[model samples]
Target chain A: MHGQPRPYWNPLVAGLILGLALLATFLVTGHGLGASGLSARLTAALGSWILPEATAANAYLGGYVKAGAPLAGWITWEVLGVVLGGLIGSLTSRRFRPKVEGGPRLTPARRLTYAFVGGALVGFGARLARGCTSGLGLSGSATLAVAGFVFLIAFFAAGFLTMRLARGAWT
Target chain B: MSFPFYDSGFWPALALGVLFGLALEGAGFASARKLTAQFTLRDFSVFKVMFTAVIVAATGLWLAEELGLMAPRSVFIPTLYAWAIAVGGALIGAGFAIGGYCPGTSAVGLASGRWDALVFIVGMIAGAAVFAWGFDAISPLYWAAPGPKGQTLDQLLGLPVPAILVAMIAVAAGGFWLGSRLERRFGGPIGSSDVTCGSEGAQPPETGTRPGSMRPS
Candidate 1:
């Protein structure tokens, strides 16, 4: 959708901006950016609406619904912001377009299939560990959360292994 | 005092989250190829942006805490557990490679009109369900080695937070340098052809195509 593959801003500069944003978050909100937790919450809310009694009884689903208004929660808003932010960024960069993102040698369907499988694993892992890369690895590290460290190790190890297996997808 | 306005309830947090997400999009971080470039050692944007933000925020937090403006204890910190993190991280990493987007990025991807991102989102939700259902069976493994919520690298290594943060900044710089060099070495020929998505004016390089490297004529 854009030329020059849409020039990227300098990483250092971008990082600095992100830092300020985070700092602002801390100052006004006393926290950091997060994504996965809310996704779980949304899932729980939907599950409950579909089967209130069962969802309420389910351990994980129960936690999110019992909390009430999963979509109304702070993290969920942040996620909404992420969506808006991404759209704006892509549009401004002239890089916005609807397409399947994947490697060569793969059809859109295949790429999407892999995306689904991979995303599922990530979701499971994030929930299993109580957080994903953002909550555990990034935010956790920011606050010196020990579980965050372990998550970093496990996540990277898995990525490396999967990368090897998915070599053809990339090449 | 009593910051984290949303923590007090919900609306404020949701607003803040959207703002943050907007910021991420503005930063052009929603793209998967851009993120994976870090792994290929071609682009260090991820490290650069992530560490810069971490260091800057850490410094500000430290200053706030030192000034007694904010109680460090009040700040939320993820409790540490070796086992849960290890297994979770590995799986997440694998998912990153296969899916080309993390939980956060997938949202961005979806916003940018990527149909595949939707699929990934569905997959993630399913995965979370599976994990939640199996939690009862895996309870023991999840709780292994619990520690103080704020236990960190500095504490474990006997270094001060500020010092460690500085070291991290330096490390990030080094990574960026390496990434640039790799890009120069591997970036295929530029302008070979930009793939367009649908009728979009001009498609940026698709996932498989490496930037900064020469594209085969």
Candidate 2:
């Protein structure tokens, strides 16, 4: 218990490290890190394999099917890498634990429900905006993209505003 | 212009993305409690990591672009589409507050052995599917209120990349300074759980300890 895990790195230091990583990606791959798009592609592919007709007929998903193996897409692979990388990081950092994180009094089921609903909303919202936090907020701002700033402000503002509604999650 | 693998291949890109993801998770971002502390004005972790990354990348890209090693255009930035951005940002924020994870973080959490992360990922995929099916009806909104696309700060304000990059670094520096002060005033490390225990890991600081709760640490 003495070493349940470690403290997080310095915020400024961590941010600088991430910033340089993004820069490296731009220099090397000419793109930034992304996760949502890849997941979308995978979803489309799985949908296609399970329900080919439906996937092909769906307006948004059909494009991905027509484009070929969705899993082969760049973002898809990158997202996979994200999962793998995360697992490795947790393992190395000694933070790998199987548990449901929620408010002190919240049940696992309630936490799961909120997680699903929140995730769906995030997905839909990310699609509408053309990206999510990492893609729009971080990568976007790194390039000084105006949309990046807008999304960042909006994201934080809404989070704070809606935070009260979910007070049970905190003390 | 002389970088060997501007288009090296899929493996490298994937590897780099994985490294980035690992870095984010390793920094304690995989936990929603950690990320949301930013808005609660409790912890400065998110701001610290995000701003630092921006500064580092901005400076690196600026220097590379200046030296002609990189053509910034290769990186993609979406068009403004104000309504979409606003609506989407709100939804994402709601998700963050409710689920304590983002698209990137949900994936990280899933990897880190959280069942909720899996649920979130599945929901995200389903949500994406729903959006895709409704794309035709939403097409207009997707491109509404179009702002600049892939427009960098240097290009927009007619400032040199170096100058703009330097300005960004300065802003981050200022933010860091303020964040530290807020943490001190806030009573704990900005985002640590209030019910502190000397458990397995080093827990984050508790919230509402600050004089003014909305200090934006």
Candidate 3:
């Protein structure tokens, strides 16, 4: 592991740790994990910065302003920790490198374009659904929530179909 | 009653998020190639890891509730909004396949200096802005779908928690077994391939190649 990056953890083991973390969060905070909510708040904050009156007038963006600073929420701090933790993990494993991730079939430009489109869709969808993979899928499912199971089924169905349609970009 | 430590704010949440990120990165979920491989049927690492985590957390939480260590009602439950959730799921699923990273994983990827992850993050914020901007127009359709608020699987099926837990465990176990077989057939061992893009003309070694063989000759 000196020159080369260390191999990733076994999936099962890493998953166990993740599960423990989830349990711990539930026990302590009386809530589960989330990602997209922070993104929404960030968006609201940005909107408020650009157009204070219009953003504050909007029902969704206005909520953040009413709640005070959008960035001063628990999820926002947790996301910041996520970035810090990821940096630590990557650095310790010697996997930190500036580059894009894509298959040989696609160029960096094309891959970035796809990434942006995908991210936008995720952002839009997460808001509509009220959560994301972490918030709705994992946390909600663990609690046996109906919405979680539904999201899981629908997510996989769309994912498989989309993957087939976009084969050239990946394969 | 004394265990939750709720009076202590932010620190616990932050610590848990860190651990969550670490587990994801260490499991190689931060890599778009590895994640997309799940959709391509080339690898099932994502499925295996996620199912395992779900089972572990579900079982543990149930046990804690049984022993009166915690109250189930205290946990935040997402309300059911049928059509919105389903459509949202479809959008997210398609995004995952195209972008190759989910919200949590993309953060890890960005932290590790993946340039594409940055672009994806920007896109996500923009998308959120778009949604906020169009909230009034979409809200009618979003709320039109009929569903019970905060319904659970056990409640929907009128099943006992123990029975549901058992069924979930079985399903997860079966999924893992099937995922392992799929990976064995369509893909190589986990983490055997490096997916970081290099200079133009550099091809990532084919799957199943020896780990060190990705280097240019």
Query: With candidate 3 superimposed using the best TM-score fit, by how many Å does residue A47's alpha carbon deviate from the native?
Result: 0.6
Give the lowest summed-lDDT range of ten residues in model 1 chain A. A1-10
Q: TM-score of model 2, chain A? A: 0.93
lDDT of 2 by residue, B20-137 (tens): 7777886777776666666665667777788788778767766776688756465666568899988888889888887778898888888877777888888898888788878889
DockQ per candidate: 0.59, 0.60, 0.71
- Order of models, best DockQ first: 3, 2, 1
Error of 2 at A61 (Å): 1.1
- What is the fraction of true interface contacts found in candidate 2? 0.70
Candidate 1 wrong stretches, greater than 4 Å = A1-6, B1-15, B188-217
Over the stretch A60-158, how does candidate 2's per-residue lDDT look in tens digits?
Answer: 888889988877766766777888888888777677766666655566788788888888889888888888988988888887787888898899888
Name the better of 1 and 2 by TM-score: 2
TM-score versus the correct structure, for each prediction: 0.88, 0.89, 0.94
Off by over 4 Å in 3: B189-193, B196-203, B208-217
Say which candidate scores most in TM-score: 3
Q: Answer with 1 or 2, whichever has the higher lDDT.
A: 2
* TM-score of model number 2: 0.89
